[model samples]
Target: MIHLLRNLALVSIVLIAAGCDRIGAPVRVDDAWANATPAGATVAAVYMKITTKDADTLLSATTTVADHIEMHTNSEQNGMMQMRPLSNVPLEAGEPFTFAPGGAHFMLVELRQPLTAGLRFPMTLQFQHAPAQTVQVQVVELGSR
Candidate 1:
């Protein structure tokens, strides 16, 4: 009876230790910002820098202030600027993915309200490998960033 109890405790400990890795995968988000929107505007853009130790993908982002969020990239085509939507942002180990203006960014479509300068809003980010992280996105003037 004692032998069986000891084996059960060891099995439980092993299972818990294995789960800790999945629960705590390290992916870091930094320098997150959004440009403040003018009154009556329903769209805005967000920028950020992300780094990860393992290969990971940024699956989606959500905020209460926006009707929906989507990832987009800007490029020049035949002397005209074009915006394209991205399905996901994939990263390699130790490589930082940057989202910036006139480049890759998040589009906040149909905003609930204008994002005012000096305001910080909570945005939750979902990842392919690491756990979902909620980050506070700071709002700045349009030309300030």
Candidate 2:
């Protein structure tokens, strides 16, 4: 009877540990901002720095200002800069993922309206292994970089 109880306790501990692995850790976004778009423009870019406590992947993003949002990376191909969609962005534990001009950024397409300077908006970021987080994004001028 004692051996059977020990085996049951071991199974219970294993199950509890497996369940804990499914819970997501926290992530943080900082210095999030969007570039101001000119009138009649239908697209804009957003930049930010993301940090995670555990390994995770950025699955997608959404904002009320745009009809569609996706992760993009700018690369030079054939002497021309090209922006390509990224399916997911991996985040290393305790490492910072930076999204800036001329690098990885959020491509906000089909703008609902022109993004004006000094305006702020909410952007929701979804992750594969973490809870979705919403952050405030500031709109800066074209020259702000």
Candidate 3:
């Protein structure tokens, strides 16, 4: 009986630890920023670095500054830079997904207000394997890196 009880306790502890692992955030965002839009322009691009402990997908994003946001990638085709929409952004475990100029970015469309330098806005990112996270995005100069 004593040995059976010890085994039961060990099983319970393992189960508890497994549950705890699912309780915290699995991803982290860093260096989030956006570019200031031109006067009267309704579109702006946002960049960030996202690191995840496990494989995950960025499902969507929302912000009050735009009617909608889309994941986009800029590529040079035929000597012209073009932007294309992405359905979702995949994050690899222990790898940082860097969103920067001339690469992957979030395109904000139908802006509610013009994006000006030195302003900050809130962006909520939803992920497939983690809870939604809100991060403040700083609007920087037009040519900021």
Could you give the candidate ranking by TM-score, starting with the highest?
Answer: 3, 1, 2
For model 2, residues 1-145, the per-residue Cα lDDT tens digits are 9999999999999997877666434787889998799889999999999999788999999999999898999999999999899999999987999999899999998999889999999999999988999999999988977
TM-score per candidate, chains pooled: 0.82, 0.82, 0.85
Between candidates 1 and 2, the one scoring higher on lDDT is 2
**Candidates 2 and 3: which is better by TM-score?**
3
lDDT of model 1 at position 96: 88
Position 140, candidate 2: lDDT: 93
Give the clashing pairs for model 2.
none
lDDT by residue for model 1 over 1-145, one digit each (tens)?
9999999999999998888666555788899999889889999999999988778899999999999999999999999999999999998987889999889999998999889999999989999988998989999988885
Colliding pairs, model 1:
none
lDDT against true structure, model 1: 0.91
Best by TM-score: 3
Q: By lDDT, who's the top model here?
A: 2
**lDDT-based ranking, best first?**
2, 3, 1
